[model samples]
Target: MMVCRVFAIFFGNCLCLLLLLSSLADANQANIDCLKTFKSQVEDPNGYLSTWDFGNQTAQGFICKFAGVTCWHDDENRVFSIKISGFGLRGVFPQGFKLCSDLTGLDLSRNNFSGPLPSNISFLQLQHNQFTGTLPPQLAQLRRLKTFSVADNRLEGPIPKFNSAIITSESFANNLNLCGKPLDNCKMTSTNSHSKVVILAALGGFTVTAFVVGIVLGFFCSTISVEQLLFRKSRQNR
Candidate 1:
């Protein structure tokens, strides 16, 4: 009976270990799924990503050793960087990058991808692709961007606001109709105070107009009352 009990305990422990490993395996598969989704959306120039084989297993397989893909250090459960630029890729911008929360580097330059630029993609080499659209205002929220490039696309419009200082003037050139300081003379947008003042002035004008109309109406009524009283007295005298 003691031997049987020992065997059961060992089996239970092994089962627990297997469950833990399975959970980790699932997480790694999630990273691969995110990459696959991005591949479908972005147009690959020079067919750089055509060699990727997502069907393989993540561990002891070609997915882990896939070129241009660097997974997390100490573990293959997440992706770290994708530096494949100047490969002549052509397609629309990939919108599923938000799923890769741990991404640090993304090099998709010299590709033919076009879409509204930026949606909280905080990266260093994520630029240089063929993305075209109003500079997404959310890009200013990415606090980790460095050496960003969208300079040579069909992008246009006044530059949106952001908290980034690393970005330079060259990042936004050769566009359709971009106008601003250091480029053209599109007046920089006003601050919060300026917008508030404009709103207040419009409201104040309406209030003043209403007040003036009330005063004029009151004066006219007073004159009419006086005329009625005087007419009554004159008729009584007659």
Candidate 2:
């Protein structure tokens, strides 16, 4: 009976180990699918992503060998970040990145990607791109974001109120219409117009007051000169 109990315990441990391996395999397969889908979505004009050959599925960390891909481990398929800056990649923000559940950092700067970005992004570096549209308000929710930049883009409207201290005017520079904290406040057109009107009114009032005072002084001086002339003529007649 004791021998049977030992055999049962050994079989249970093997089953548990197999289950864990299977889970890992599934996660790795998901990551592979994420990359494959991402590559299919973008336009790689420079052939930079050509090394991403999906032919070899048996090799461990094969995806990590692809250009611009960073893995959490040398021997694992878990992606940590993807830095594909200046690749001349053109496309709307790739939705395939959502499949990469482990992705933390993404740098697509200096590319020609246009259109709005995904609102649920946790990390981003998208400077010097052709991206347009207002920054999403959901970006303020990224409290864990360590680095963020969207400078030199054609984005417009009020920037999200990010709480990170690292964000400054430089982070949002050259974006023609972007405004908010770390940049000029939004809706300043009306304030500026009102200020101009007030200044013009003050100048007009000052000019009118000065002209009235000059006229009063001139009239008083003219009257005194006339009296003096009349007095001199009277003396000459005497």
lDDT score of model 2?
A: 0.92
Q: For each candidate, how many residue pairs have backbone atoms clashing (under 3 Å)?
A: 7, 0
Worst 10 residues of 1 by lDDT: 56-65
RMSD of 1: 6.5
Q: What is the C-alpha lDDT of each candidate?
A: 0.71, 0.92
Model 2 residue 119 lDDT score: 89
Model 1 clash pairs are 43-91, 44-89, 45-88, 45-89, 46-88, 109-128, 113-130
Error of 1 at 127 (Å): 5.3
Per-residue CA lDDT of model 2 for 1-238, tens digit only, reads 9999999999999999999999989888989999999999999999999999999988999999999999999798989999999999998888899888888999999999989978888788999998899998999998888889999989999888889998889889998799888898887677889999999999999999999999999999999999999999999999
Which pairs clash in model 2? none
Compute each candidate's TM-score over C-alphas. Answer: 0.62, 0.75
Model 2 C-alpha RMSD to native? 9.6
